[model samples]
Target: MEHLFGVMLVWLLAAVWIFLLVSWAITGDVSAVEAAFGSVVALLLAIASAQRAFPYVVPFSLATLGGGAVALPVLRAYLNRAAHAQMDAELIERACLAYEFDPKNYGALINLAEVCYKNGLLEQAVRHLEHAIQQAPVMAANEKRRLRMWQDELQHHPKLGYTPCMHCGARSSVGAVRCERCRHLLLPLLVHGRWVPRQLVHKAVAVWGIAVGASALSLLWREQLTGLNALVAILATLSVALGLIVWVVRR
Candidate 1:
């Protein structure tokens, strides 16, 4: 029975890491380091204790850890781009620097186009937008139309640069109140390193409240954890790693 419990503990650890593996899919969460640490340690522990069938655990761990590693750099870059593209006076200079660094950079082209349009430089805006379209041929029709609308608008009108949705990282048009790709509010609050949805954060708080209350009641009704049972519980929680990950990502 203790052996069975040990196996269960390994499986529980596996579950914790599995969810954090595709961290790129939830880039909006902005908890890459936390996800990476949570996943890597749990995965290593699981692999050390795994039974038959997960022969590919080692390579798979690499994929999960590497995906998380990829996220951290991407997040840093996105934040840098956001700072440069927003209402800063050096928008043109920064965009040009990014373009020179990567001539085919889609974000750079889009930023240049918006800057040109805002300054009433129609031909330049069209040129940049055309270049941007080339970089992303699968651009939506509405998005294409949205970018070109600068042609009909007043000169020197503020055609601010595009920004990736804080939640989904999909590009959003200037002045849009919501992200077209994810339908999340465009303006999200920056908590810690992530721009999390206010509603989701509120929900997380309520979830914690309910969870704590339930745990407290259960503890009151039961004997205090000790010995082998306590050991199982600690292992099941990944030695507090899983709990910390949830808190950092949500809080």
Candidate 2:
């Protein structure tokens, strides 16, 4: 176990050094290596002091760490674009097939339309969304209206050739995955055809979680609840953190 940690530390430092070295090589910027100097040294010292690994140094300059702040965001944005550039064709086909199996379902139809729009089938997307709106029942009035608005926008605005938000009529750049006005995803794993703002649903859920958390804290303060009752409330409160972690990791 001790040897495993030592090897991991060695590989981690080597990886960081190589990354900075490569960044410098490609960008012809010394700051790429210099900016991480202090951090790398500190980590090495900490590991050596803990007797977990030997102290080592890379090609980084010994000067005070600075510069390269501007490069970070540019690098991150490039990576994000690269990540979303390719579509998983098989996944899309499966989604389309699933929607096909339930053509009469309004939510399914809207989902199909969203997929079609993403795949650049604008006419098909508009037609499916229009069908959803026409078939949507009274209970889905608000949702249907939202769909109607987007469908109408699509019909009138042929220049909206890019991906448009299902929730908002605003169109984003081609290959973009989110609406500029609404930061919610433009892709699937949607909730209820996502006619409702994801932000609203998140806020509602956060409020509910806060209420539950407060209840649990009050129970601890009062110390009056039974063991089972207290345990249940505490678990419910703790579950929020776990839920958020899962959502973030999966996303």
Candidate 3:
């Protein structure tokens, strides 16, 4: 029975590792260090399997401890790399998508332009912003204000050069809210012209809440954990909740 229990425990650990591995593949959440840690864990598991399958000279407990120590670092590196890769991919996608603006929807154009600007595609952003401003009315105060804002923003950051709108041939400020020549009101529909999908934010919050709830439950009812572990769990739960609240407010 004791031997059976030990084997079951090893299988359970392997299952958890498998779940993490799948999650890493889906989300790219693990870094190079974490990948290395996972490899180490696999190595240790192999050693343990060998020892269990065939009688080994080394003590079982020592082997298990050594396996754990080697696996931890590998996991850390893998997680870091995965997370970085995911972020890079998202950024690249956002940059590419920012240039696909609808001409009639000046608000969306401005939003896309702003996203492009933030992503370091400043020239493209400026061009889009100029187009939006040109479509605005010349006498509209709001449009003029927006144009001025963009112009001032570009002035301070000269990499985003002034480009006269092809439609109106106006040398308008990016900061101008309206076209000086045509008086088009260039009102932005979204905040800073960036399209933040509410769905993504909601999903992030939901995941954060679930993780926090799990952590709280683990800390509250877990007798297996040491006092320090319990405290850490509680703190992590609180931190996750706090972070979620902050993100929601900011978004």
TM-score of each: 0.27, 0.31, 0.30
Q: What are the per-residue Cα lDDT tens digits for candidate 1 across 1-251?
A: 65455556565645744474445437654356545545555565455445422333333334444443454456446555554434333666567567767878888778877765654445556667777778887964654896667555534555446644667888776534356898764432111224333445434434433343233323322334667775565455453544654764576
Segments of candidate 3 deviating more than 4 angstroms:
1-22, 25-41, 45-108, 138-146, 158-251
User: Which parts of model 2 have CA positions greater than 4 angstroms off?
Assistant: 1-72, 81-92, 115-124, 159-251
lDDT agreement with native, every candidate: 0.53, 0.49, 0.50
Model 1 spans with C-alpha error above 4 angstroms = 1-57, 86-149, 152-235, 249-251
For TM-score, candidate 1 versus 2, the one ahead is: 2
Where is the poorest 10-residue window by lDDT in model 3? 185-194
The 10-residue segment with the lowest total lDDT in model 2: 57-66
Decoy 1 TM-score against native: 0.27
Clashes of 3: 56
Clashing pairs in 2: none
What is the alpha-carbon lDDT of model 3 when measured against the actual structure? 0.50
Q: Deviation in angstroms for 180 in model 1?
A: 25
What is the overall TM-score of model 3 with all chains considered together?
0.30
